[model samples]
Target: MTISNESDPFYKRLSLNLISIGLIAAALYIAQDILLPLFFSMLLAALLLPAVKFLQRKKIPKIVSIILSLTISLVLVFGILYFLTTQVLNFLDDSDMIEDKFNGLIRDAQRWVSQNFHVGIRKQNQYIHDTAEKIKTSGPALVGQTFLSLTEIFSYLIFIPIYTFLLLYYKDLIKKFLVDSFRNSSEHQVVTILQECQNVSQHYILGLLIEMTIVFSLNAAGFLILGIPYAIFLALVGALLNLIPYVGMLVANIFCMIITLISSPDISNVLWVGVVLMAVQFIDNNFLMPLIVGSKVRINALATIVGVLIGGALCGVPGMFLAIPGVAVLKVIFDRVDGLKAWGTLMGDPGADKQREKLKDAIH
Candidate 1:
């Protein structure tokens, strides 16, 4: 006869852990609208905390310091947004030219396809006409969905600032709550987790900003050297979009290529755009990321990818941006908590011998 696994301590613990994880995932998904803004605001407050404290050091009132910190952050954020918006509006102002260029590109594509693949122009036209008809049929639904998405975005914008301010204002209360929630035996662990989480947020967000600025400068320089129109706009767009992880740069590359093709009237410039962006990506992945963003978060590649995919599935792009930091924070918690050291290992890099040994000792 066999022994029952359910009677084992490991099995009992595993079951409880799985149930807790399932409940947490469901809660996050269901409460995303309320939680997402709060989470984002938490990150913002963490990033700006030093500035707030510095102002207080200068003998400024705490309330005024908080307002000043928030004001500077908001101005920098909205200034970039305003610039991007103006660029888009300027692009839209030349709609007739864009349409003409698009049609010309389509014609060029059809000709190239005919020559290379022996597809008839008439057949291609028929395929395009059918696709257009399908799009026309679904256009109204698409429009409604877009409108709803925009409304949701604006609502988040309103809530995020309010939440951020409140979070900063009540940070001490929250810290006290965390300390009181744990027993004396675990109070130090709770405090360690809080400090680690704050450090992770600060480093991760600050590193990303530095990375983005460098990337934007490089991209702008490359585009300017190639004499690409709207060079700065495309560079900024590409740099900002690259924040979304693996999928982002690919989309940015395609977008920049399409814009280059449309505006430059040089097919070769499209290829150069791809080449330049790829070179930047290589530098970013191999050099910049390792030195900057990946220094604090030692997540394994597989875990990062899986986390990003799961985050995107659960909460879309914002979730994708949050995934790495979320995982980093979770890893920190897991390493400190009993019975979860293995999970910390699973999320962390494999070749970190010192870290692995430390984890092993903690587990023991």
Candidate 2:
């Protein structure tokens, strides 16, 4: 006897699952404002945990260790900000000359576009003029909005360190509390999942730092070789932006090209700047990132991109930066659960699966 579609167990479970997902999506959308800060705090805590552990091993008191770590993090952040601010102020001070240089570069760009795409330079110039006029009209309001954004950023900056410190101080207690609070076969599974999440987070954070350092060094060297002004500032900005995944490289390249154009009106200099950025991206994608961050979290490229897009849609750049690690942690937990194993497989690297299969064959 054939079962009715609605009465079938598989169909019933599928409907329930879809409904559950819809509810979750709704809740997440509603709770996004609160979730953003909490998510950032959690990520900060994960990144700082290894440092906290290192300090603890060195016989530092937990409170002192937390303070030290927070201080170091803040100092680094402020140092970079100071450098960037100085570079920006200097650029503004030279605004007249920079504008002239940029105008020349725009003409060169229009010429290139005309040559390559058969586009009319007159229309391109008019488009550029219109864009400038729009910016002129909206500039003050945009500046005000930017200031408001900076204020919010500073608020989160203050909140994150405090939250991270508390998490580090109470991390063991928190883990114990979780394990003790739940008692059952499920509790053991939960504990295992938590451990896996922690492991993945720690690895991702450490690997990211390593990757950033490589990118920074490579960019700095390239910029300096190309005689790019404010090479240090540009390189630092590019490295930090690189943390945001796929689009970060494009953003960095645009910023670098703009800076180069403003610094030197010569088309050759701007071309060299583009070449440098391309070279850095090529090395980063093919060599540096793979060598440094390879297979650490077992996250696949597509999942990472999708996660970034979803995160950006939800909460902008911060969301984009946090997305992959958040998804990676979830994937780790899902892999340990029989019900979610398929999803875990979907999130994981195909290369990792191949490696596992090869290892299994060798073991047998």
Candidate 3:
């Protein structure tokens, strides 16, 4: 039943692949409301699978292992929430001081701008005054909305661990079903791809955790040294945001600048804070991440960006966070398929291609 080369079946197969991709995209779009939580659950399960397996190997009962793993996860979540709560309360307690410092900084900046550019300081002051009044009027509503958001977040938090444990407990059944449903020839390929996916996801998630820890620790130390108010809160926010990829660092830097301007009211402190952020970013981009993440997936920057955008558009922040590893898994599966190898190449790291070329030249 093999199609001979003269039949030119490649084009037909390619068309089929395109059709399948379109169908999958449409299905996902239609089902995203339910799919998002399932996707998050799967991701959490994937990240914790290695730990679960280790516990199993240690002769832990499956139920006990799931319980223990989820308990640790819950404790970590609560600890972070408690820390954030404490830091936020401290910030609120010093609200009046923060507001006075912010106002003084704004006045100084307005005066400097007037002196240098001959602009009307009074109009600028009026603008600031109007903005403050608007904020004052809307602040309570905004606070109410924020509380609602927090309630929703906690609701999601409660489900994630429960879902993660169920996934872990049923992982074997899921794998067995997948393998048994596939054709004999395809089963090995499917299993290999799944294992590779697990490895890729584990590396990405663990690498991200390491990266966040280092970034948060360094930023917190710098902020504390610089006497920045709410350093713990800001550092934690920055670390969590860093999981979003690409623009996360920029957001953290902007936040730090705003806090520095409002808290210190000193141009030197603001500039120093910016410098610290840049230094941390420089180290992260150049040294720490490369050493830690280290060629696990070999996905290119362009593909990564495109994947993140697609994921974000599909499922918000969780989608963005999951996108790269998801794409990597897709690429790995595509590479193993004879008809889809071209797509795998298209998604792969250009550096890998260069290395292949270099090896070919050496062989020649």
By TM-score, the best candidate is: 1
lDDT of candidate 1? Answer: 0.88
In model 3, how large is the Cα lDDT of residue 170?
86
lDDT of each: 0.88, 0.80, 0.79
* TM-score, predicted candidate 1 vs. hidden true structure: 0.91
- Which candidate order results from sorting by TM-score in descending order? 1, 2, 3
TM-score of 2: 0.82
Candidate 3, residues 1-364, lDDT tens digits: the string is 7778867677688789999988877776777655666766777788877777789899999888788877886688689779888988887898899889877877788889999988899888788889999999999999998997687576567667777878888898989998998856699988998888778777877787788899999889998898876778878877787777677778888987887678765668878777877888887865565555645767777888898888888766767887877888899888888889998989887775465455457658
Q: Single out the weakest 10-residue window by summed lDDT for candidate 2.
A: 352-361
Candidate 2's residue-wise lDDT over 113-185, tens digit each? 9999999998887888899999999999999989978986877877777777788888889888888887755
Q: What TM-score would every model get versus the actual structure?
A: 0.91, 0.82, 0.81
Candidate 3 colliding pairs: none
**Higher-TM-score candidate of 2 and 3:** 2
Off by over 4 Å in 2: 1-28, 57-59, 104-144, 352-364
Off by over 4 Å in 1: 1-7, 112-120, 351-364
